[model samples]
Target: MPQITFLLPDGGTQTLEAGDAPTVMHLAIRHDLPGMPAECGGQLACATCMVDVPEDWRGRVPEASPDERDMIEDRIGSLPEGRRLCCQIAVTPALDGLVVRIPERQG
Candidate 1:
């Protein structure tokens, strides 16, 4: 299983072992982590599952799809520099030590 580190809004960190969760949003919802309500579940319709991919990890993770970018940039307005919809990020073995920052609030 891979491991994921969630940087909370309070400046704390939660590291979880990714079991069968398909995406980062699923992991957050499964563990009931704050800052990620994921009201729309894993669907692309909701921007509630936003997370910030640190600069170092940007190269490793795939770029956001066109739909995701449009949702964030056009609909949600300006977010953090590395803002990404966690729903679009697959939980893969290669992301074992992935670290993501949960914004203070979600759209």
Candidate 2:
């Protein structure tokens, strides 16, 4: 299982052990983590599942896809540096101890 740390805008953190679904969005939704709407249901069509991976943790995770890149460029208030669509990333052991920050607001 990958242990992920989610940092909220309010200066709080929630750590979870995730292994079932592949994406971070799935993990958040599974735990009913506050603010994880996943309105698009893992589709790149929505920006509601944006999360920011820390600079140090970036290499441990996969880079965004071309579609995801376009979404970030197109959507307002999209995730900033190190931001990624949770739906676009999968759960992997390499991401263990990953720390990601949720934007104050998402699509």
Candidate 3:
């Protein structure tokens, strides 16, 4: 299992122990953390799972898929370089201690 740290908008952190299967959105919802809506249940159609990857780890993560990129640009607001759909990020041992920042707002 890998541990993930979510930095919430309120300056609080939620640590979750997630196996290498569930997406970050699933982990957040499972732990009842705020800021992640996961409204479409991990589907890229929704922007409710949008998050910002930490600056230091920006390029470390894979580039967003075409579908994810399109969805982010169309459904979500402007896409920052590190912005990603949480549903598209799979939990993995390599992602242990991954840090994600929840955006202040979601549509």
Clashes of each: 0, 1, 0
**lDDT, candidate 1, at 15:** 99
Segments of candidate 3 deviating more than 4 angstroms = none
Estimate the TM-score of every prediction: 0.94, 0.91, 0.90
Tens digits of lDDT, candidate 2, 40-83: 89878877788888889888788888889789768864446798
lDDT of each: 0.89, 0.83, 0.83
Record all residue pairs in model 1 with backbone atoms less than 3 Å apart, i.e. clashing. Answer: none
Better of 1 and 2 by lDDT: 1
lDDT: worst 10-residue window of model 1: 73-82
Per-residue CA lDDT of candidate 3, range 2-101, in tens? 8889999788988889954478888888887788888889877777898889888776677789889888888765678888988898887878878999
- Minimum summed lDDT over a 10-residue window in model 3 is located at 19-28
Question: 92, model 3: CA deviation in Å?
Answer: 0.4
- Writing each residue's lDDT as its tens digit, candidate 1 over 1-107 gives 99999999899899999999999989988998988888788788878888999999999998998899888876567755789999999999999999999989786
* Candidate 2 runs further than 4 Å off: 77-79
| Top-TM-score candidate index | 1
